[model samples]
Target: MGSSHSTPVAPVEFDHHLVSALADNAAIPVPSPARQSTIDAHIHARIQAELQRLREDEATVRDEMHAALEKENLDRERALAHDQDSAASSATLLADLDQVRAKVDRFHARRDLSQLPALREARDGLVVCYKNNTSTPLDCWQQVETFRASVSELEKQHIQSLQ
Candidate 1:
């Protein structure tokens, strides 16, 4: 705590040239409010246009899918119709086969009757018995002929039913 001496400090002063240089360096041009708004509007319009294009593309895909489904349905219907027609034709053919089978059965029956030796032996026996018998009426021979005609008629009726 000896004698204290204080030195006086000078007040700092700003240089005008430096201030002006700094102001010039820091100055930047700003866009007008209307021009900035117009740029924003343009961006918004482009975004809306893109959204609309996406919607249209979605609709087109849906329409194409619908058309494809309809075509598939038509194809299925056509296949079903073809199958029905084929089945009907097959049924008709089977019916014809049944008729032919019946006709063949009739022919086989007739051939078997023609090959029967028992019928010929019976006929020969009847002839010998009639020649030996003096009491057998003449009407008995006519009755046998009638029975043969009835058998022939029955065979003809069976053949007609097959046709």
Candidate 2:
């Protein structure tokens, strides 16, 4: 049988605290105060610039909205003024048309008299009778009474036909 020999192993001592400290230091960055302040200032400047830009944009939008509203109000006022002018003109035109219609109605009434020669003659004769005798025309003339009775009978017949 061969003899077997084993060498004794030495115990090694490790500084765990030093290793842990080194590892902690390596994991976290520690900046100088001046550098940190400079970085903070840069960040602050960027934030302030962004805020100022946002404020300017908001003011621009507000101005645009105000201008738009003012323009709309102006347009509405113009439209209303135009409508009023048109209404005034229409009223004047309507009045003129009514006056013209009254003249036309007078002409039509004269034309209707022309169409009824007998009525026109009877009316002329009655006028003459009244002119000839002012106080006692009814007793002297029968034409006026006949014309009135005819008109009344014609109106009654027309009403009865409608019913």
Candidate 2 per-residue lDDT, tens place, 29-133, comes to 888999999999999999999999999999999999999999999998778668978778878999999987876675556456566665677777778878888
lDDT of 1 by residue, 71-160 (tens): 999998788668978678878999999988978887777666456554555556567656766586564575457556656665676668
lDDT of model 1, residue 67: 100
| Residue 123 displacement in candidate 1 (angstroms) | 93
lDDT of each: 0.76, 0.78
Query: lDDT, candidate 1, residue 41?
Result: 97
128 Cα displacement, candidate 2 (Å): 96
Candidate 1: deviation at residue 18, Å? 21
